[model samples]
Target: MRIFLIVALLLSVSFVAGCSRRADDRAPGGRVIVSYWEKWTGFELDAMQRVADDFNRSQDRIEVRILPVSQIDVKLMLATAGGNPPDLAGLWTFSVPDFAEKGALTPIDAALQRAGIGRERFIPVFWDLCSHRGFQWAIPVAPAALALHYNRALFREAGLDPDRPPRSLAELESMNEKLTLVELTRTGRVVRLPYAQLTPAEQRSHAFMIVRAGHLPQEPGWWLDLMGVWFGGSLFDGRRITADAPGNLAAFQWFRDITAKYGIENLRNYGATGGNFASPQNPFLSGRVAMELQGPWMHNFIGKYAPDLDWGVAPFPAADPAAGKDTTLVESDVLVIPRGARHPAEAFAFLAYLCQREPAEKLALGQRKFTALRETSPSFFAAHPNPHIREFVRLASSPNAHAAPRLCIWRECQEELRVAAGNALWGMATPEAALAQVQERVAWRWDRMQARWERVAEARRKEWLDRELP
Candidate 1:
């Protein structure tokens, strides 16, 4: 709250210091320059840049200028507050709720209706992420979906069939047990043993370190709080925080058990021995971690760091009997026109062109991601950089697929839940206790948010409802 207040003060100051409107800048030939601020650099930038270049070549009325901006949310906040925001901003789907609620974004429903675009065009989960507060706020460009990526060699080493992947939580745990390795390090006497065979005393001792972890929940730790979706619950359901929901309790308990068995010191030692995520020694690439939940971007890292590593992708195993099949988390880089933009139509024109089948497929192929479009060109898979692109595409269309909650306090909720899960996983508290605290804290935050909304509801709704897009 204090940080928010500080930023709010900064925003008011910037508003008073009013800056030039860069979005209104025109080209030499009087073409409308649609300012697009994105955080993509390297080939990711090139992929979108190519799409922008194509759009410019295909039209004469508008030119989409792609500018690389770091710390997009902070920069975008200041720019929007200063009334000089870019015409279009490339942001993650997770950011929509907060920005939309703050009136920092222009709802795209009017433009979507004007263009005759509707839900039938894209995958449901991706399309859902673009909507919040009963309004369409953005359009997806390149989408990423999470799945379990396992080392084929490790499966074979553990006598598990390389062609078959675990489909349920129990099977995943069983396989994980078979694949785990613990090393006894005492006076240069090195011996490896199955973790299950270790006595409680040996398990608790610092004399051993886990050299291989089949699947450490904290390996990347990107989706800890969202794990409840697999167990059949969510963090927030429109009006309430469900941090201590039954499914979440099960999710965090499962986490606690894993953390307890693995021994934090052992796991930390193993993690210390591995290189950074992007490096060749990345636990997964080096075979330290046999399986992990990751997006299609992992293919690029594998190609660059561990070209010879044998790997395959599959939907993450479900932790529950119901609502668990084909479970996946999807995310995307989305395009939106900010609230103060001067060229909404022109910016959207470029977005429409890019969202079309050929260009969308082209952009996804370039970025090594998949398009949110319902249909892809026949040759898209053939040209895609990742051979497993189809799996992610299939997962994105899963009925169980989910994205970040559509709530203004999701960022706060995410952080709180992450810490709560950590408190359980690090043995500081039981899952029940940690999540209960989260439930109480988040409920209070939710109430505060509701109070603020009640105060601003009339004015904000009027602004959004009366806004024009032409």
Candidate 2:
């Protein structure tokens, strides 16, 4: 009886001591903090935070601290340059290429290989963009491709069936003409699609019109893709850009004709004022516009802001049904490891896990986000009731989905396009002049890029040749 009592007393004392030690060891709890930077805001941000919360709850080794950065490129560059980068980050795919080129990113291939993950796990085009100079750089999280979002109310009111949307670019033009309304006031002020003034429908329309006129390329090797289908010519010979090719000029001229006939307000300063897309005042939501070329997220915006507004989803009208084949632009959000991160291994492990199909789908659902890593089937979408939400996944999986050229000058390229379009819309330059200027700028940038690559390639070759073979 005496011995038992002594043993119990000893055990009690030990337990107390252990508890005290744990308490003393904690400095705001023994949480290993991992800082994460992401560009998503609004509902998109909530979704990302949920993923972080889930990951944190799943394990105890590390706690993720998410910082929502609005200007992703600016913040990320500053952090990297300052050598105090976040342990993990979420960035757009285009942003990753530049980071990888500048050595601001770390290669994650070793971690991916260790985890037995492969490129086959993600959508091919998204995966392709993450590779820079023969190294895997980042893990893809969400993919959003360009699709069609149309106002069904307008179609029904126009005495047309909303169920049947435009299938080709020609059909879209015909529908636009039918849906267009020109209300001229007694004061001689013309108001077309009065509701369009309520929202940024004109800007949205301009982007689609640019596509229809074929100013953009469908692929890197093709002559401007938008033109190849619209004007019937390729933009490249595989060796150089053929933006000024005969077919391309015709396509640009056709696009200029639209601006010449209509007012430029539709193209410029149309959508710049709207703060949020998911609002009742949205031009498309208000039924001021008949059609839109946007993404699946627009459906969510409508559900939250204007559920009563009838709408339908469709593929973006093809420039030329016979020639365009089903071209769609594929873009994605990715997780990148900044250079000189403190715990790169752990960061990459978490990223790799999230990039896998099952967990990715779960994270996606919980956050209402899309996945760049392709899901196995409809199991993920089947769980969600809205069919429109699945449109991005469907289009992303389609054969027509393709990534833009993985050039380092991609930033300049996008800038050129934006400026050219702006100038054309503002009446400062005709479509042909704007495009010709863009071509010239592109040619100069390409030359610089080629020179840079040649220098790097030559050095690498020499290094290999100079080394002794064992």
TM-score per model over all chains: 0.93, 0.77
By lDDT, the best candidate is 1
Off by over 4 Å in 2: 1-31, 185-251, 265-278, 457-470
**lDDT for each residue of candidate 2 in 292-320, tens digit (9 for 90 to 100):** 66665666767777888877877775666
In terms of lDDT, the poorest run of 10 residues in model 1 is 16-25
Instruction: Give per-residue lDDT, candidate 1, residue 65.
Output: 92
RMSD of 1: 6.3
TM-score of 1: 0.93
Candidate 2 structure, TM-score to reference: 0.77
Each candidate's clash count: 0, 8
Pick by TM-score: which candidate is best? Answer: 1
RMSD of each: 6.3, 11.3
